[model samples]
Target: MVPDGLALPDDLEGSRNCGLVALSVVARCSYAEAVRAYTDVFRSAYQRHPRKNWKGGTTWSLVVKAMASLGVQHSHTEVTSAVTLQRLAQFTRRDALYLVCTTGHAQVVKNGWVIDQRGAVPVEQHWGRRKRVTAFHAIKED
Candidate 1:
């Protein structure tokens, strides 16, 4: 049964789609308090995993899952200085950073904070092959 005002995502993978939906709702409602409460729950779920801290407690997969549960489908852009200050300011008393990416395609840096997709820059120009057509130069450099 649906809880009083609780809404469910169309997909059974509610853990994923729910977040995007929640974001939409919160955006429309401008309900930051409700949004924070929901996101806090998502963060708690993420921390439950045993390996959560292995990779700085910040894995793309877990971030995506947490966002999904909260109804945020996309990722944020770069992690910049200003963005860092902004995101740090958003942290609850709990001290967990909510991951928001710029675009849904893949993770990319934006501002200074690691948020969900907002806008994404193409990899072809900066990361694609130099003279090698199919080979990515960035990979070779590493």
Candidate 2:
């Protein structure tokens, strides 16, 4: 459950397509379809590729390709500084928020939370203290 004093936006929780693979799956389906497709593909992808190395782990390129395969368009931005929740808030609302961390890990942000292959949690709890965000992709519907 979301923590107290954190008012999640209406659009946030319902549309959380966390994790690189999960985001890719969301891109494959229509917005309506994505609501039900959450994390389904992520589980399958991990089952297929359990390794976490560069070649085996989920990467931004892979996410891009997955989205492309479904005809989704997106724009990428490289973040030079530590990306805070405030910085992320500046982005225009889109279908999903794909973030690449300095550690080379990728996750998705929706509403005010971060959703990954493992599960969903508040952004501050998931990324507020750990890895620095290195880049972001604003996904657009085709």
Candidate 3:
């Protein structure tokens, strides 16, 4: 699903940092840079300690704001339909970037490639097994 030279060359994966890692890949930045950007947005948008709710999983709002902080534009509207990740394209543009959020998880989608803590892979090989995507943040094209 990923084109040549598209996946993060040195992805910094975390046990519970799928959201951060996805942001890192989609923003095309280092994991450290993604963290810093997320921290800035987390402070302003969430107004609470970063990772205070991490155990509960990162919120879609935090992910979207972090993208904006890194200059990756996205649509603020959150589609709450319960669709599987594979069916995401039904609601979002096929060639766009998005922060696809499941009930308690988040991953980055770009041109049908799913980027998570495990790195970029075909959306089918993603955190598999019928992920009912609860939210979708379509990154706007310039």
Number of backbone clashes in candidate 2: 1
Model 1 alpha-carbon drift over 4 Å, by segment: 1-43, 46-57, 72-119, 127-142
**lDDT score, candidate 2:** 0.51
Candidate 1 — what's its lDDT? 0.31
Model 2 clash pairs are: 12-111
Q: Roughly what TM-score does model 1 have, to 2 decimal places?
A: 0.23
For model 2, how does the per-residue alpha-carbon lDDT over 1-142 read when each residue is reduced to its tens digit?
Answer: 6422222223344433343335543454343343333334445456767673233344555555556555567788888766664357446363355444445566656556665544567666775436666777766544
- TM-score of candidate 3 against the unseen true structure: 0.76
Backbone clash total, candidate 1: 35
Question: Which of the predicted structures, 2 or 3, would earn the higher TM-score when compared with the native?
Answer: 3
Candidate 2 displacement at residue 104 in angstroms: 2.7
lDDT of each: 0.31, 0.51, 0.69
**By descending lDDT, how would the candidates be arranged?**
3, 2, 1
lDDT of 1 at 10: 29
Native-referenced Cα lDDT, model 3? 0.69
lDDT of 1 by residue, 1-142 (tens): 2112223222323123323433333222233433454455545765767564332123334434544454444423344433322333233222222223322222222222222223222222222112111100010000
The TM-scores of all predictions, comma-separated, are 0.23, 0.53, 0.76
Clashes of 3: 0
